[model samples]
Target: MSLATTKTSKIDRLAELTAKKETSSGASLWREAFRRLRGSKMAIIGAIVIAAFVVVAIVGPWLAPYAPTAQTWRGEVFANQGRFVGARGENLFGLDHLGRDMFSRMLVGARQTLLVGVVSMLIGLVLGALVGVVSGAAATLGGRAGQRLDDVVMRVTDIMLALPSLLLAVSVAAVLGQSLTTVMIAVGVVQIPIFARLLRGSMLAQGGKDYVLAARSLGIRKRRIVLTQIMPNSLSPVIVQATLSLATAIIEAAALSYLGLGNPDPAVPEWGVMLSQAQRFFDNAPMMSMYPAVAIIVTALGFTLLGEAMREALDPKLRG
Candidate 1:
């Protein structure tokens, strides 16, 4: 056989192997990742932390001993004289500057905190993934026209990425006006560029592989190829990123709240709003700030750990 025939045979063989790997019951990446995750200490710890936080966010408020906003113990604490009450029999987390129950406020605020992170991450994921699918599919399948479309999309994302993430979110919040929805949108917008870029790059990488080349050579429809083959394989990094972005979303939401661009209602008990309130008495009563701050840090850490574990588990290099 000619050298060209030999090369073609090798490519065909490689494609057959890839197709078999993709179709095999035991070749599932998600299932393999789950098995790896189960064995990972980091994943276990992170899961525990996340589960505890979620349970608290869901149930802790219902069992709160005192009203989060009530100042029934106001007379006991004196902010003017810098005399704050420490944790005691009556109040577990001690009194804030306003003499409100810290424990109760934290419990009630957990829901809002979780809500902000989840909503923001979802907004980013949905919008960014849509953008990525268009850009990636075009660049890989649309030929010259596709490349141009991808270019236009990427250039816009690049501009957004060029700006500092926090600055962009702050600008968005500033434009939208202060509210919880505004915060979620602002934070979510900041994540769009990251996801778009990641997914587009991932799909492009997949486009060059033997399976894709074989599919193209076999006269498959571009849309079917993209939707069925390329899209599924390219989603690994994006999935991991979504997990990591949750942690970032929570922190960014809090930052917005700390900047006074959160829910306008002072009566609402949110972790970010709570932190903003605690900053005033940080010097006088550090515990007021400490509790919420620690909570935020721990929650972020838990997500980060889980994300890292997932990345490791999903790594193709470790499949052996």
Candidate 2:
């Protein structure tokens, strides 16, 4: 063939390859996962719930009709006789034992509740991810010495995991004493082992993949290979774990608060604290407890649903 004809044929082949790549089902892992996530009913519902919750957390305090700590209708509530005022024209959610407006308290408390969950989860994620990276790096790239280091780290995480999560949180709270910081630290500590173990295992799996071997063969630096290749591939599980951890962190934080280890200020309304105090008059004022309990459940469920949806989307096995 003539030289000009051969050059034209090569250009046509290149165009064909580019077209095939463009028409592939997934553009990239994250984009494809997001596409799948958008189609999931559970994800849609969870996203809506979480969005509403975040809005409330951000503005609920400002929008509250009355001061959350105010006993505006003290005389109206007769908790001893189970005669607290039901939902009235003024107090939409009725009055608590102390005649505080349930609606107002619920609104103001949302910020604190979300703060505890997000901050505690971040605590676990940062510290746990740090440990996992160190351990996984040593095991994959450090030769025999690295393997031993990994063994020790894994053993420590195993010990932490052996204990019941709630019991560990309670123990931490007791040692730290009663405070909002104590509750966040306690709940966050419980998640460390879980996130650490998950990330480490994911890295180990990814370390043996074909791309890692190819990177090694290409004379890529160890640090570069781990950071650019293995680390990114290993993050899917960690991301999913972070989502799931948010749900558990909220529940555990609430449990600590209910146990009287959460924020020392009684005037501040925390959902868990509200639930704890409402039990005193639960027989008559079920609405007080119901309000917080339902809020907690719905919030946790939203995170759980979103986490589950993410796990499915990120799983290569689930890909078509």
Candidate 3:
């Protein structure tokens, strides 16, 4: 055979092999992560629990037997000079100080709590991601000017970190006035530093990887490289943080509400508001406090477990 023909045949064979290899390895990172998540028993259980909570939040008002704030003392036997009352059959969880059905209040409260949690977390996630991306990109791509910007952002983050999260939230809530919006803003503000720092660190690490270096050498635009390449690669940690911070945000919202810093109206059926009201009846009726507290705990646990499982699934080091 002629030398030119032999060379052409070899090149064609190599191209065929490369195509087969590329096709075989076509699964994206997200697809693999999802596959890993499906195999995680903890992730599945946590997902189930979270789904249940979401369903309850959506349909709870309709399922409730009575208006959350409606006063009804239909079937209660007074004891201890009318200080304590027997559980009414109509109100499975009994009644509060004003005779509102505890079960109804709890059901409605789920919607309020989840709304605050989800909304606040979204605010935090968006603001934090913006700050983190700017800071990370500046530090990675900017020269001395970028360094100064990064320093300023990190210093501000450090200041926020120095303050206790709940205290910061309470202060913000107090300043904003007592309302659901105030509670959401307070919790979201407190969470900003956490997400900012996490994403910044992830982006910084990703910036130093081989792919990023190659992109830079190939004359890709800095913005394109950062947004399309680095940002996507660094988002696993942020996603995990978002899941975990959701639990924290819920607890913080409740705490702010408990402190009389959330939802000024006493008639609103919020978990935190319910707890605050239940405090006066702690001695006479403990069930009022028990119900809301359990809801908070279970909801937080579900998010936390799910976040941990996501971390394990996304992180190759943790994968067995």
Ranking the candidates on TM-score from highest down gives 2, 1, 3
Model 1 residue 281 distance off true place after TM-score fit, in angstroms: 1.0
Instruction: Tell me the lDDT of model 2 at 224.
Output: 95
Where is model 1 more than 4 Å wrong at Cα? 1-26, 78-82, 217-219
lDDT of 3: 0.80
Per-prediction TM-score to the true structure, in the order listed: 0.89, 0.89, 0.87
**lDDT top scorer:** 1
Q: Which residue runs of candidate 2 sit more than 4 Å off their true CA positions?
A: 1-26, 78-82
Q: Residue 237: error of model 1 in Å?
A: 1.3
- Tens-place lDDT digits, model 3, residues 1-320: 65434533442332222111011247655666688889888888889889999999999999999998876663343323435454667778877777678888888989999999999999999998899899989998877999999999988977787777898998898898988999999999988877777777777777877888999999999999999988876776777778988999999999999999989899989998889888888887787788999999999999998988877666554333
- The sequence of per-residue lDDT tens digits that candidate 2 reaches over residues 201-283 is 67776787788899999999999988888777677677777888888998999898899999999779889888888888888
Compose the digit string of candidate 1's lDDT tens values, residues 169-221: 99999999999999999999988877777777778778888999999999999
Instruction: Indicate whether candidate 1 or candidate 3 has the larger lDDT.
Output: 1
lDDT (Cα) of model 1: 0.84
Deviation of model 3 at 190, angstroms: 0.7
Clashing pairs counted in every model: 0, 0, 0
Error of 2 at 99 (Å): 1.3
How would you order the candidates by lDDT, starting with the best? 1, 2, 3
